[model samples]
Target: MSDPVDRPGASGVPEAVATPRSRWRIQIIWLVPLIAVLIGGWLAAKAIVERGPTVTISFETGEGLEAGKTKIKFKNVDIGVVKSVALSSDHRRVIATAELTREASPLLVDDTRFWMVRPRISGGTVSGIGTLLTGSFIGMDVGNSTKPRHDYTGLEIPPVFASGVPGREFILKGADMGSLDVGSPIYYRRLQVGQITSYQLDPDGKGVTMHVFVNSPYDKYVRADSRFWQASGVDVSLDATGVKVNTESLVAILIGGLAFETPDDAADDAEAAAKTQFVLFHDRAEAMRRHDRIVDTYALVFKESVRGLAVGAPVDFLGIVVGEVVAINTRYDPVAKQFSIPVEIHLFPERFTSRYTKGDQGAGGRLTADRQKLAQTLVDHGLRAQLRTGNLLTGQLYVAVDFFPNAPKGKLDWSANPPELPTAPGGLQSLQESVTSLLAKLNQIPFGGIGKGAQKTLTDADSLLRQLRTDVVPQARDTLAAAQTALNSANGALQPDSALSQSTSDAMTELARTASAFRSLADYLERHPEALIRGKQEDKK
Candidate 1:
């Protein structure tokens, strides 16, 4: 006992106090952490349950889209948020991961479209302008189908009209699209009621095919035979009507537009079908006049040189254009064995048949009958084809159709399909005839014989002049000189004391005495009343 005390060195006042072992018991304080963990797990499960499916949208660019910030909207109502944005493997597009709410799950269909919304200009209008201030968001369009989808491709441009817009579509075929761009207005009598949805090149590449949308009410006015024209900007045309400035409105003059008008005589009962293609005229006049006139073709054989005549030359009737020369081809007349130039002219009637009877084929038949009757009447009226001068400055010739009273009496051969018109002497023919007549008159003169005679006459005249100058002149001079000498001698003989002067004085005295005696005898005879036939009565004085 002493050794154990020394080893332990126990210096206790009381022996070991016996204590009971404490039993393991549940503590309410530990349950606080467990309860908290359970509540957290439940909250996590509820959050996951409400969150909808995640979709991946591929876009060409992620300009304004940001992960964890951008929201997806429908009609401006946010329904989803972007989760992630990363470049695709090929780097051609940006892969956008978005989480859509459960309520929008049904909207994600095969035809659903998704696109990042930013301020953009489309169809000449501004849209998504609100995105400029607040921020950009994703836009979604619901599809008609019910099939759900997780992937979508974006639209480059917004649709012309949303799914709710009500309108009908039509197709217009034109030579060219002109200035009618996308969103160009469609005018009905200067009032805009529609717009151009799209345009593309025709399948055959010959023209442009425009996709047009005409709103209701206005579209009802379109008839089967209505005219459609491109009202693009301003149309300035010059014709007999003078300067025509045509524009539907100021807006049309800017961006361009489409216009339609039904002719007054057009059938109002027949309506144009949807997508029924119509020719889009560049001008309103052409559209209105397209089907109004009837065209007739005729061939004329001409013998004159058609050098100045060309295709597309006008065929005028009384200074009015009635036709155009389509072709000038050579033809051989077997019976005459002569090659002649045959001119084919396409004639549109000067006046259209105004009144058309009811029924489809009726109008056409009546038109043909009227044309045939008119042709017969014209032929009887001496309608003749001739080549005449059109432009004097250009020396261009055109075919002239006229009623000639002096045309070599001929008849039109209407038995042919394209009625053969009668021909007359063209301007060139008359000119040639005049030239030939002039040449014949010139050739009739015997120029050589006349020249010889003239030559001989001139020689004789020269000889006569020489004879007068030499022989006749010298002889006359000699005769004149001899006469003068003789006269001078006679003058000298007749002087005062010459013998001729004395003889003259004696003769004059005797004659005077004889006269006195005669007078006295006559007086005696008068006194004796009948002094009969006495030769002389002498009186002594």
Candidate 2:
């Protein structure tokens, strides 16, 4: 319609004058708003990407835990934020839903566990308070465990930290639980390398199971052929020595520690499955197989008391601890019609195998395998059972193996079967027999004749005393009267105030001193008869 230039701005004056400036203004107005919208969309995408995925971790209690506040930590660094906390379908557990950053997603392995961090009593565990201020989440540990990873249920009490390792699980029965304490050290060759993990009573409530864990590398050192004993609590005693025990540390002596030893014959299988965790001093099955010798046990049955016996007492084969008494039980034997106690004895054949063959086949071609030859060698080398006293106060007896070359061998079968030799006599039996024997011997003596002779001697002495009284007393009295008459005549001749009175007083004092000396000599002789005998003997010598 109108002119082309007049169409612009619809002003008749000039269309070109306002056109450039107006378009510039319009472009400037729309550019800022579009740029702002694009920036907002980019920020939303970045936030979603940083948030990563939501994972659910279940827990028993959420006491110190807060949803949307607590963070999941890995290696002491914050990695994720907890989204929400809600009850599971059972309503018994709390499930913490967490959103982790994409950077942390790769760290979440199958073995990852989630446990709440709070201030604990024994040692303060402080965490998540930083998250409360910074609005960040806690961290978690994620890695493959050597042992199968178990889902964590919140601990009612504080849980102890333990690293999982591959090892056989053995239950040690009949262990003294009070003697074993948690954190007590376990020794291999007197070197402490492990600690007791935990302990609990068995289901049957008859025994205690001690959980011991050996750290890696050292775990391989412990084989299935290991032997264990309470190294710290064992006691040894001697009559003269009194009680002797090795007590190095107060903690070891009081708390009691475990010891493990490897045998010489143990297989050198390096690839064998290591026993990283084992129950100490229990599990006899593995221990028995590891020991290559048969234990010899003897039941010492006696009608009378045997002297010197005690538990932890040794049964010696030539003064070695071949075995010990495991138990003492009493039963009435119908055939014997007497109550007999069976003392269980255990013997380890490894100690004596060097001298004797194990099997019955006399070693056929091998001289080293003959049992009879071994028995003969022992007898020829002067092997004998010597009765040794164990506890003098308890009167317990132990039969000690001794070498007696000159001792007479009685007529008994040493070959047919090892003869049931005598156990050293102890207890009331020895006292009863000794008393009975003494009484029997006393009955055999001629006591009646001896008593009559003593009575005759007394009668003769009495008759002599009567004779002395009748014959000697009158004559002595006459002599004394004559002496007194003579003393009076002499005194009268000497006169009252003469030098003779002073002389007489001095003479009487001298006589009294002599009598005192004689009394002292008699007392000394009576008190020390041995001194007199020794003086005479020495003089003769």
lDDT of 2 at 54: 67
TM-score of each: 0.58, 0.52
Q: State how far residue 353 of model 2 sits from its true place (Å).
A: 3.8
lDDT, candidate 2, 98-195, per-residue tens: 77777866655566556665533321223345544455434465556544332344433322343345433233444566466666666666676566
Let me know the TM-score candidate 2 reaches against the reference structure: 0.52
Model 2 scores a C-alpha lDDT of 0.60
Evaluated against the true structure, the overall lDDT of model 1 is 0.82
The residue-by-residue lDDT of candidate 1 on 24-49, one tens digit each, is: 86688999999999999999999999
* TM-score for predicted model 1 compared with the true structure: 0.58
